[model samples]
Target: MDLEVGDKVSLIIGTETHLGFTVLIDESFEGLLYRNEIFEELKENQRIAGYVKNIREDGKIDVSLQPQGFRNAIELDTEKVIEAIYDHDGFLALTDKSDPEDIKKELRMSKKAFKRAIGSLYKQKQIVIGEEGLTLVKE
Candidate 1:
């Protein structure tokens, strides 16, 4: 398939499996996108951009919605959190202590990713993490 790890590819969303959604990669390869890795709702026949996470020796492929590196993922997740906060009048009721399902439902992100993004935002002094929620730091 000439595909390598981290290669960008197109995916046609397929049926849901216990593990994840099956996808048609580039309309040629069959790959699986794990449920835990997904942050948004996907429907059958949905088309989206994806990256090749792995090509198993058994020929099964694994794909990811976010680009495979910490830098790329953190940046995107941070932006999403920022936007959500802004949309909520500069505060979002989510914190590191929030339930993972709550974070996923609210932000479509895993708690780990949410924590990393919030950590980045906190380090940048862009947001304040309080017991109530996250507040955008005003200049």
Candidate 2:
């Protein structure tokens, strides 16, 4: 694909970003995501994912790998989810999950993606859904 600044890409295991010990994208390109730029706390080898935000003249390409589309794109889900889980009880109903829906209304993703994130949070046991609403399982 024509990789340029502000393009989204995925990185699998055993890749290098050329800049450092990053899990590279396309197994060749170097991603440009910094810790401060990420809304989520990136763990070591946690798989840096974002968009390509720059391409330098030195033949090194810069990628964001952020799940969010671009700078102009709506903010990502994980951050919002974390915020909602912390602000609310973490029991957002499929029908009453307002904060996540605020994101959805802007992002235009299928419901599947939204629910998948909830499933991920559930799997991580970070949050639990109940009749009371979504509640944070951990701090």
Model 2, 27: alpha-carbon shift in Å?
A: 2.0
Question: All candidates' TM-scores?
Answer: 0.94, 0.41
What is candidate 1's lDDT per residue for 1-139, written digit by digit as tens? 7999989999999999999999999999999999878989899999999999999999999999988989999999999999999999999999999999999999988999999999999999999999989999999
Q: Give the lowest summed-lDDT range of ten residues in model 1.
A: 34-43
Q: Which residue ranges in model 2 land beyond 4 Å of their true spot?
A: 12-21, 65-72, 75-139
Specify the highest-TM-score model's number: 1
The residue-level lDDT of candidate 2 at 98 comes to 43
Clashing residue pairs in candidate 1, if any? none
* Model 2 lDDT, residue 71, Cα: 27
Evaluate residue 56 in candidate 2 and report its C-alpha lDDT on the 0 to 100 scale.
Answer: 76
**Which lDDT tens digits does candidate 2 get at residues 93-139?**
44235464453553334344556555666777877766645677755
